[model samples]
Target chain A: LAKTTQPISMDSYEGQEVNITCSHNNIATNDYITWYQQFPSQGPRFIIQGYKTKVTNEVASLFIPADRKSSTLSLPRVSLSDTAVYYCLVGDPYNNNDMRFGAGTRLTVKP
Target chain B: SAVISQKPSRDICQRGTSLTIQCQVDSQVTMMFWYRQQPGQSLTLIATANQGSEATYESGFVIDKFPISRPNLTFSTLTVSNMSPEDSSIYLCSVEGTDYGYTFGSGTRLTVV
Candidate 1:
């Protein structure tokens, strides 16, 4: 199992870009990086997933380098509603059943 | 994205009692996952449920304490048996999406007093 490390919390202003990075030095060959957003009293929702380079979605973008040791989740324009816990997970797509969640970065978007 | 409906959104149970939480997915999935989140903590994987087979629990979680049943491809249940205050947490059901990520149920907030 690959363990991920990220910041405990972050602060961002509305309309500004927010980047959350996660480091997983033990990432495997087939492992992919995924980010999830979770609000209070609710289950997490998928944000973006990427294997290499960059993958963009309507909500967020995930950037991974060649080494794949770490990745960053970039939110284009954060808002108040975007304030939530963001989890970065590294796992093999084929066997993602064992993926564990670490204490995610608590992002607070200010006006 | 698949939608998941979880039953008993919130329940307050007495100690030593058991609470069974149900999850129903609109579409069929190969694997269903259960997770627990304690107060001011992160999510922890409890088990993975596959249809017509025994659930695979994570380390520190036992079937006797957190039994899971996946009767079909689209529905599964997780029972927290002999509940204690330590077991009071938010239980969530999730299904891996066909393409990239996983979809999660609304979540069940369980409080054992």
Candidate 2:
């Protein structure tokens, strides 16, 4: 199982672009980086996933470099409601069943 | 994409009692995962429920304490047996989505007093 490490918490103001990075030193060849957003008292929602390069959805964008040892999740013009815990998971969900979650970063967007 | 409906959204149970949480998926999935989240902490994987087979538990988790049942592909149940105050946490169920990510249920907030 591949383990991920990210910051415990982050502070950002409204309308600012926030970037949260996760480092997976032992990432596998078939592992894909996936990011999930979780609100209080609710389940996690899938934000974006990428195997390599960059992947952008309406909600967020995932950037992965050539080394694939780390990935970043970028939130553009974050709002107060966007404040939540963001989890970075590294695994091959297509072929593996051991999908584990890291400590995650708690992003607090202030006014 | 799949939708999961988990029942008994929040419950307060007495100690030494068992609570069975049910999860029903809108579509069939190969595996259903169960997770636990303590207060102010991250999520922890409990076990993987596979249909017609024994559930695979992670380290520090045992089947005797958390018995899982997967009678079919669309539904599964997890019973937290002989609950204690330490077992009070948010229990969630998840399934791998057709997309690259996984879909999780809203979770069951269990409080054992």
In terms of lDDT, the best-performing candidate is: 2
Query: Which residue pairs of candidate 2 clash?
Result: none
Output the number of the TM-score-best candidate.
2
Error (Å) of candidate 2 at residue A85 is 0.2
- Minimum summed lDDT over a 10-residue window in model 1 chain B is located at B97-106
Residue B37 lDDT (model 1): 90
Fnat by candidate, in order: 0.86, 0.84
lDDT of model 2 at position B99:
74
lDDT of 2 by residue, B1-113 (tens): 89999988999999999999999999999999999999888899999998999999999999999999999999999999999999999999999898778999999999999
Worst 10 residues of 2 chain A by lDDT: A90-99
* Candidate 2 CAPRI classification by DockQ: high
